[model samples]
Target: MNRNDTLVPQVFADGFDPARVDRSRYFLSLLDEGRAAGLFSEALFSLRMNELMERLAEQIGLWTNGRSSSVMQETAEALLNNLLYLLDLALSAAPEPRAAAAMLARTPVFPLYEAGMLAARRHLDRCRVYELALKKFEAMVLLPPGPAHFLHGGLRLWLDERDLRFNACEELYVPSSVFGRSRRLRGVAEAEAALAELCERLRSNAAGPV
Candidate 1:
């Protein structure tokens, strides 16, 4: 946790770089080191998570006027995953990985859960309009050569499934693809607009002009 202390050798100090090493192996090595240093405990983490899950499920049930236990449990699990995802983002962005891990270990679980829940609420509110837009987009079919032409034009678009594909001739890309440019969808409207533009292009190509 000290600024003066480097956690590992300089080679290992940098965060997970796929080109340099395997991601799972790198994280596993770090996890082993943290466990050895008493900075991590599977038992303690599990206990805290279990407690948080129960509390979250109960609270969600109350808000929903008592949903089935199975539904509440699944929802709580998803929220917990969201909280961990935020924690992962924090760790990845930290300049001091060792100190970040130490701080994470020292932090209480509920505060992190609360923060994640608040973030989810804000995101849902911001994207609410996009919800119906995405649904409508999903229902439409990208007739014939329209999809091919759109991608072949070197433009990128996000699908409702959260995958971004581009460069129609060579390959379709997913999140893990090492090639092509990437952009996060600002909202469902962005994707919907892209599809609408593609459809309009099809109409123009078919009819010559309006």
Candidate 2:
């Protein structure tokens, strides 16, 4: 197929029919190659495109699941986290002339995006802990408040806060006790480790050849 014909197929391949993905990916790939060759403009463009793709993926995941999946829910959660990371990288790499002003202008969207990401992350963490707890031990351990319990409680609070903050924006609210337990048990270190692993995987995927 010709370039124009390939556009639609590529969009479909990426799990969407949005007309922009092809052009976005094309320019993004060019940016990537240019950056690899030490061109700053291409690097900047790649960052911008990455930010856009992260947002698009997030919306698609939300619309597709409506916050219902137990297993696939992590997919949505990871999208937000990945977006946040990409945004951070993009902002950092942005030229000094425009970076501060541009990020300041986007402050309003940032908080909402962050809250959504944290909420999803908390929920997914809890779900994972819930499953692990159920499988590993029949009953709760009676030791002093440990990693598991702490993770669980933190998730519970985070989830509650997210609901309160974003209730207006969200279509539905789904609570999971499992997520809370998972948060408590996992601890910040473990959570960070997992997040790092996920980010690495996503970066690998994103950086792979088109």
Candidate 3:
């Protein structure tokens, strides 16, 4: 089945046995083989797998009553176990082990700095997407949340910057004042700067002892 077609089953709402859903097992198998063959980057693959696991958790949560049956609990546990296993594998495959070790020998500050840089860059990208979406909040609200929350939140922050009291629940009725006026452009600029700084930090840190 296409990944996109993996719908949350109605049985989940009635609290069906999670063990009955075998597709996760199949996906895990595919991931394992992909990793073994080096057909995918471990970090990227782990991130994607984690996303899938999170979606699964969300579906299960929505479907099952808080008091899950034994099979449901077991399935949840299995999913958690699988996520952690993949995480461990991804961390073990980090590309800068030698550099990290050498940096550790030089200064405790280096590793922290390096990690900070990487995190900043990731946040910057996140913020940029957010800012863009914020600028087009009306257009954004029409799109589904799946991958768009990343952008949606950024736009919300922009509204916040403008002293605009926007609620996502209000949905798509953005006044021209909010979208057309130049008053809120500063938020976008600031977001851009923040993102740029994050990218610079990442580049600098990666070029460090690591």
Candidate 4:
């Protein structure tokens, strides 16, 4: 596919805020490096994209007097899925900057394109760990005061369901839960560590190649 010449090659190019430019460049650079290493996934991308979409939805929701807009939600989901496919394809190719032009020409860069890299690169077949961690997350939520704590990039209990308050952060989900007394992770470090261990576990199928 021919690269779009009109593309900005970067996300934040307002040219007014130096800090924004620098920060965006840093993230874009991380994406380039991370993509080269094959450490990116559609799930991670969706997580970040949804966060942005949620915020946008909130503002637009206010304009519409708190009315729920399923259309906007659906549109965001579709866009994220398409973007995920494009990033997966572009990163797979791993092309270099062949030539520079007088003007800055770049493709659209998303915020978590770098974060999607820094976070868990893939969703493994060993979902057992996520299953267990989710149980932990559930137990925490069931506690008195209704637990609210950090898990990875975001927080928990965004959506409530029958017997289980779920949607902890973006990348997590809890469909249902069971009553069980178990040792739950207490600290942020502990929770993050356990999540990392589970999400990073390599599946036998995904081990061979990118």
lDDT of each prediction vs. the true structure? 0.40, 0.38, 0.37, 0.33
Candidate 2 residue 4 Cα shift, in angstroms, is 9.7
Where model 2 places Cα greater than 4 Å from the true spot, the runs are 1-127, 130-143, 148-152, 159-210
Sorted on lDDT, best first, the list reads 1, 2, 3, 4
Q: Please, what are the lDDT tens digits per residue for candidate 3 over residues 143-168?
A: 33422453345445544443111111
Give lDDT: candidate 3, residue 26: 31
* Model 4 lDDT per residue over 37-80, tens place: 33323343334345545544643454355665644666455444
**10 residues in a row with least lDDT, candidate 3:** 163-172
Q: Which stretches of candidate 3 lie above 4 Å from their native place?
A: 1-25, 65-72, 75-210
Span of ten consecutive residues with least summed lDDT in model 1? 163-172
Q: What TM-score against the true fold does each predicted structure earn? A: 0.37, 0.27, 0.22, 0.22
lDDT of 1 at 28: 33
Candidate 1 residue pairs that clash: none
Clashing pairs in 3: 12-63, 130-154, 134-155
- lDDT by residue for model 1 over 1-210, one digit each (tens)? 632132222332334323432222223333445555555566544444565566556555654567555555565555444445433333433345465545445544455445534443443343334433333433554234333433433234322222111110112232212113443433233334444544455556556754
Looking at model 4, residue 161 earns an lDDT score of 16
Scored by Cα lDDT, where does model 3 land?
Answer: 0.37
The digit string of per-residue lDDT tens for model 2 on 27-129 reads 2332343334333233344444555665656555554654643335665554444444333333333344233223422333344356535554554565455
Model 2: lDDT equals 0.38
lDDT for 87 (candidate 1): 36
